[model samples]
Structure formats: structure tokens, C-alpha cells
Target: MTDKTIRHIGAPASGRSTRERLNPARLLSWVSGYETLVLLGVLIVVFTLTSDRFLTADNLQNVALVQAVTATMTLAVLMPLIIGEFDLSVGYLIGFLVMLEAVVAQHTSNPGIIIAAGPVVGLLVGLVNGLLTVYFKISSFIATLGVGILLSGATQGISNGKVIFENIPSSVTTLASEDFLGLSLAVWLTLLLAVVLFYVLEHTPFGRFWYAIGGSERVAYLAGVRTNRMRMTAFAAAGLIVGFAANFALAQAGSANPGYGPELLLPAYAAAFLGVATYRPGYYNVLGALVAIILLAIGFNGLSLLGVPFWVQPIFNGSVLIIAVLVARQETRQVRTG
Candidate 1:
């Protein structure tokens, strides 16, 4: 072949080399590393345009308040995810803890004791989950699922399928009504936890160890990382976070409802998985989870304002979870291939 024809055969007719067209930077730019953030921005803009109340201060505050519980749970789930484990019982744990708090509140007027019970129960649940999965050789998914079922039954038994409507301590009510800088205390607490968790997950050796374990438990073990301990710690941290979430839930509702906990499960997982596409792309991060929670809260609030049916919220959450999983898998594969 002629030299010109040979060159033509190697290069596109558009005068671009194959390598130039397939450049990683170009591909990544098109994919956008911050897909979740971009989606969130788009949703915000759309909602703002569609609903006059969407951007109002009251509405925004309400979104923050409503999402606080989910955000806390998302943080809990994120820890377990970092260590390559799932805590399916978080939603049920919230129910169990809230019921436990309410039952305690009925008997005691001291808010300190009532509040202190949350973390204790959370730690115990975490310990059980960790031992079951790490030591007993059960899969986290199945172990937590079984644990969650037990929690559900316990919650029903504690509350007797009745919502606690009275004897709620004043402190608990104050937590729900008290506002700081125009936001509810629960919202502020969620933000505070997010900040603390972000720092720990991104800047500490403990966090890195969990990430290492998540990436490859075998490799982490060979490298002298305490894989089992880290995994167990992740579960424990998750349980502790869930305990806090229960406290927030009780404060916000001023009552304990046996059925409310399971409703949070799908949304919490959705937020955590959706977060995988933000900030860190393939890895779970607190900032991403927080952003995801905000996005979901806004989306649901906007829809409700537009008179959408209640069932639609779960549909949206489930769809987001599926999409997030696909995006996370794609990102991970890209990282491996690259």
C-alpha cells in the first residue's frame, strides 16, 4: 500500500487517531466523575422550577428535618459497606431502639437514662451482628436479615403493635422542636455526624484499614491488617449510628411506632448506594451519602407537594438504588481495567 493509504487506514477519516478518540481523560470527562452530584443539581433545579414552595426556607428546613434520620442510617450503612459487609437490620434496629427508649421513658422521667439506652442497645446489636458474620462464618446479608427479623418481632412485642403516644419526655420533644440557626436539632446533629464521619473515613488509619478490607480481605490480612477486627468494628459503628438515628426518630415523632422503622430501610440503602457515584465514585463516602440524602428528600418533598401518591416514593428510591449499583459497578470495573 502507498504510505498515504497506510496512514489513512490507521487514522479515522475525521483526521483523529484512534488513541486520541479513546483517551481515558476524554472518556472520563464524558462520564463525569460526579454523576450523583450532577443528578442532585439537576433535580434541585427541576424542583425549584416546578414548585414555588420548593426553594422556600420552610420547605428546605423541612427537607433537612425529614432526611436527618435517613442520613444517619446512611452513615451507619456506609461503615459496614466500607468493610464489605451489609447491616440489613439497621431499619429494624431503629424500631427496636426507639421502642426501647419509649418503654424506658414510660417508666422513668430522667431523659439522660432514656437517651443513654440508645447507644447501649446499638452496641449490643452491632456486637451480635459482628460475631454472627465474622466469627460464625455467616454471610452478612443473611445474618443481618435474620437479626432484623428478630428485632422486628422484639419491637412488636415491646410496643405491642401500639404507638407510644404519651409520657414522652420534654427533652425528647425539645429535640424535635428546638431550632438552631433555623434548622431542627436533629438536622444539625445529622450534619455534625456527617462531618465527624467524613473526617474519620477520609483522614484516619482506621478508615483506611476498613477500605483496605473492603477492597480485598485476603490481601489486607496478608498485609498485617486485622481484617476480622476491622469488619467487626464496622458493624459495631453501624449499630451505634443506627442507635443515634432511633433517638432522632423518637424525638422527631414524639412517639414510637413499630412499623416506621422498616420504611426507612429502602431509602437508607438507596442513599448509601447513590452516594457511591458521588465524590469518590466507586467507594462509599459520608459527603456523598449526605448529598444523596438531600437529593432524595428534596425529590420526595417536591413530589408530595405536587400531590404524587405515597407509593411513588419507594418506587423512586428503588430505582435510584438500582441505578446507583450499576454506576458503582461500572466505575469499579473502569478502575480495575485502567
Candidate 2:
């Protein structure tokens, strides 16, 4: 495996032409590849000028905390996307898991067991998703959408259509209460997850294999990569990741509410797509996702400070997602044409 070579589908997405390196068009392409950063800067400047609160410490901390769960969910979305699969169930899945955690907390005084159940059950959910897509040959979108819907109902049923908040241990809440170096432990944990994933996806042989699979499943299979198994593993791993995030979320809120999952789903996807158009261009990378997450966080938080209506967030997210997909396509096309 070490001797094998796996080519990325978007290796040249960020590569600029040396012949006309300074040409306006070339420069634009390069800039567009990193437009998320530029957009983030613009949003920061605009919001700072527009609202005095934007630059304050309290507001900044709120921004980070608000996007913390989305940041974690973005990581969950990244893994399956790298393998060219979509897990639409993620938002619902994680939401359900959080509710489940609250239920566990209410039922037992054993903190460790309550916390431990999240990832374990999440892993099983991921496996089910894998089974649907791999063995059953269902479309990834359909399979995940169905799972998400099912979980939405399950979340309501198990929690009796009410919020869950009782006997959740202080340890669970520590993730939100504790902060080191000006960031919550949950935020630090999210960053750590991003870094670990960056390594696994960019440095490890497994990462290369994933790129190969994303590039072309048939080609990877012919090259001796266990494509199906890897795809399944990706979903399962994503679920496990989301499970941990759900726990952090449960810790932060110390409770769970129905309909919490769907709200983040669109934003997570938007951030993931924006990531595709960021640092690595057409490749879905953790670093890119982080930037995109910050970009979205700033944009959404800024808009809120402007006193916009609640409907604006979804509109903004939809618009960003559309723009991100277009940019990613352009990057991919540029490389393909070259």
C-alpha cells in the first residue's frame, strides 16, 4: 500500500497557470479558490463597521459558541463527502443522539455510561446507513434522507415531543463551562478533531485511498482498494464523530429539544460545500471546512446583529451553498480543461 500511488481528483484545483501567472483571469481564479477567506474578511469588516457589538469580546465568544456544534457537524459531513457520498441524516442523527443522551441522563446517575452510549449507538446508526447504501444499493441521498426522517420521528417519540433536561452531570456541562486559552473545551475538542482528520486525510495512506475512492470508485476497486468497505467505514466514522459532537452539545446545553437537528443540517452542508471551494478548492479538506465554518459563523452572526428576521439565516445559507457549488464546479472544470 505504501508503494501504491493514489491521485486526487482535484490536485490542480488550486494550481495556477505559470505561463500567465499574473494575468487578471488567473489571479481571479486563484482568489476565487480562496474566496471563503476573502468573504470572511469582508464580513468581519462590514459587521465591525455596522455594529459596535460585533468586535466586542462577549459577541466574539458568542459567535464561536454558536457555531461550535456546526463546526463539529461540518467534520462529520466531511468524511462521507470525501468518499463521494452524502449523509443527509447527520443533522437528524446527531439531534436524535443528543435527545437520547438526555434521556439516558434522566434514567441513570451513571455519567460515564450515559456519555458512552452516544458514540456506540451512533456507530450502529452509521452502520445502518452503510448497509443501506452499500449492500442494499440504495442511493446515498435517499438512504440518508430516509434515515434522517426516521430519526426525526424517533426523536419526538422517545422524548415525548418535549425537551429533555434532568440529572445531566456537571461533567457533561463542563465542555461548555470550561475554557482554556479563551476558547471553550468543546471548541478546542472540535479543533483537535479537525487537526486529526486533516492528518488522516492528507498524510495517511488511508487518506489517499479515500481520495482515490472519491475520484472513481471503479478505479479504486481495480487498484485493490476495498471501495465498498471503505465507503461503509466512512459513514460509520462520520456517525461516530457526530456522536461525540452530540455529547459536547448535550454538555453545552445540558438538555435536548426536538427540531434542533434540522436547523444545523443546511448550514453544515453549506459549510462543507464552501470548503470544497476553499483552500483545497474541489477537494473536501478539514482546513477548508474550518475556514468555511468561520466564514459562515461570521456571516450569520453579523446578520443577526443587524436585526434581520429569522428567515434570513436560511436564505443566506441557501445563497452561500449555491455560490459554493458554482465555485467548486468552476475550479473542477478549470483543472479538467487544463
Candidate 3:
């Protein structure tokens, strides 16, 4: 093999006609990398054309507000995924924390303390999950699933198997109502989290270590990457993010429900997996996850505007998740076989 790398191995000479330059493999690769992005554009165009209200500023802001929590959870889950592990309890963690947040608010009107409760607990849960998976050698699926079930039961107990709407202070309840430039605080907070994570993952050695660890634990360990510690840190970071998500959820709804957070599990995971199809393609990424969240949110908003049945959401999310996995697999293959 030559030392030089071909720009596009499948492409013919540049001197060839423009038609020859438009090779199928190149096109497929491009499309695969930006699958969600392309779909997002298509959806926007379709919905804008079909529904008179779809492209309005008010409706778009509403979409942003509605998707803020899902975006946060999706971002939270991306940490464990980047390190080549799963945190099935991601959903339940949010559920438990939101209930906990409500309880905190109920007992104390201090906005600082009330908001702090969620992230603190979230960090602890992540630590416990890390202990089970990284230290005890338990499979992540089993460990996080166990934690998730425990959280589910705890949420039920905390809220008495129902949503908590009473004793929530006016300050706590109106947190999400604060807006800047027509967008809610929830939207701003989620975007802030995304930017921070993006920089950490893309511009720092810490991020490189994570990617190395994800590539191969054994290899990263042999290279003195402290695979176990980093893996635990990943889970912990994920928990911290979920904690913020809980706060956002509580702020937006002005009430805490036992099962509300858990319901977003499918869409959250869908965004996380679909993230692999864009931005940094062939691997899990923060930016990709954010984009995926917007795509899912817009898709849902468009469908709802078209008067689709409530049942269509699950099917739509499930199909996107499956497609995301397939696209990710193919992109990984391309990266490897190249």
C-alpha cells in the first residue's frame, strides 16, 4: 500500500466528467453521516408546506420547550455510551430525582437547595452504578437495570404512586418560565450543558481518554489510561447530567409525577443512538445527540400538527432507533474496512 491516502478511493479521476465525480459510495457515506440531519430538513420542508402553523416562531419555541428535558436526558446518557457501556437506569434516575426534587421543594422553599438535590442524587446513583459495573464486574445492563427498578419503586414510594402537585413553591414552579429571547430557561440550560460537554469531549485529553477507553478497555488500560476509573467517571458524569434533567423536568411541569420521567426512555435512547449517524459520525458524540434530539422533537411536533394518533409516537421513535443502530453499524464498518 502507498503512504498516501486517496481522498475518495472509489472516485474516478478528477479529469472525468462531473457525472463521474458523483459516485454512489461517496454519496451514501455522506448521507449516512448526516442521516438525521437530512431527515430533519426534509421534515421541516414537508411540515412547513403542509401545515400553515408548523413554521411559526411560537410553535418552534414550543417545540424547544417540550424537548428540553429529553435533550438533557439524551445528553446525560451519551456519557456511558461513549465509554462503551449502557446505563439503563438513565430514565428511572430522572424519575427518582424529580420526585426527590419535589420533596426537597416541599420541605424547603430555598431554590438553591431544592435545585441542588437532584444533581447530587444523580451523581450518587452514577457512582453506585459504576461500583456495580466497573468495580464488581457486573454487566452494565444488569447493574443499571437493577438500579432503574430500585429507582422506579422509590419514585412510586416517594410520590405515593402519583404525581405531586402540592407544596411546590412559586419560585420553584416558575423557574422554567423564565425566558430569554423567546426561549424558556430549560432550553438555555440544556444548550449550555451541551456546549460544555462538547468542549470537554472534543477539546480535552480527558475526552481522548474516554474515546480510547471506548475503543478497547484492555488496550486503553495497557496504555495507562486508567480504564476503570475513567469508566466510573463516565457513569458519574452521566448521573450529574441526569440530575440537571430532573430539575428541568420539575421546573417545566411545576409538578412531580412518579412515571413522567420514565416515559421518555425510548425517545432519549433513540436520540443517543441516532447521534452516531451524524456530527462526528462512526462514534457517539455530544453534538450529534443534540441534533438528534431536535430532529425527534421536530418530527413529533410535525406529526402532532398533522393530527396523528397518540399511538404513532412509540412506533415512530422505535423505527428511528432501529434505523439509527443500522446506520451507526454501517458507518462503523466503513471506518473499519476503509
Model number with the top TM-score: 3
The estimated TM-scores of all candidates read: 0.88, 0.88, 0.91
Clashes of each: 0, 0, 0
Please give, for residues 234-336, the per-residue lDDT of candidate 1 as tens digits. 9999999998898898898899988878888877888888888777767788877887887777778888888888999878767776787687667666655
lDDT values for all models: 0.83, 0.84, 0.85
- Candidate 2 per-residue lDDT, tens place, 1-338, comes to 22212123333435766665666765665476677787788889999999999999988888887567888899998888998999999999988999999998887878788888888889999999999999999999999999999999999999999987878889889888898888899988888888899889888988888888988999999999998899998999889988988988898888899867888787787788788877676888888899988887788889999999999987887787788768777777776676
Candidate 3 per-residue lDDT over residues 8-103, each given as its tens digit: 234455688777557676666546567778889998999999999999999998898777888989998889998899999989899899999988
The order of the candidates by TM-score, greatest first, is 3, 2, 1
| Pick by lDDT: 1 or 3, better one | 3
Model 3 residue 324 CA deviation (Å) reads: 3.6
Model 2 worst lDDT run, 10 consecutive residues: 1-10
TM-score for candidate 2, please give it.
0.88
Instruction: Give the Å error, residue 305, model 2.
Output: 2.3
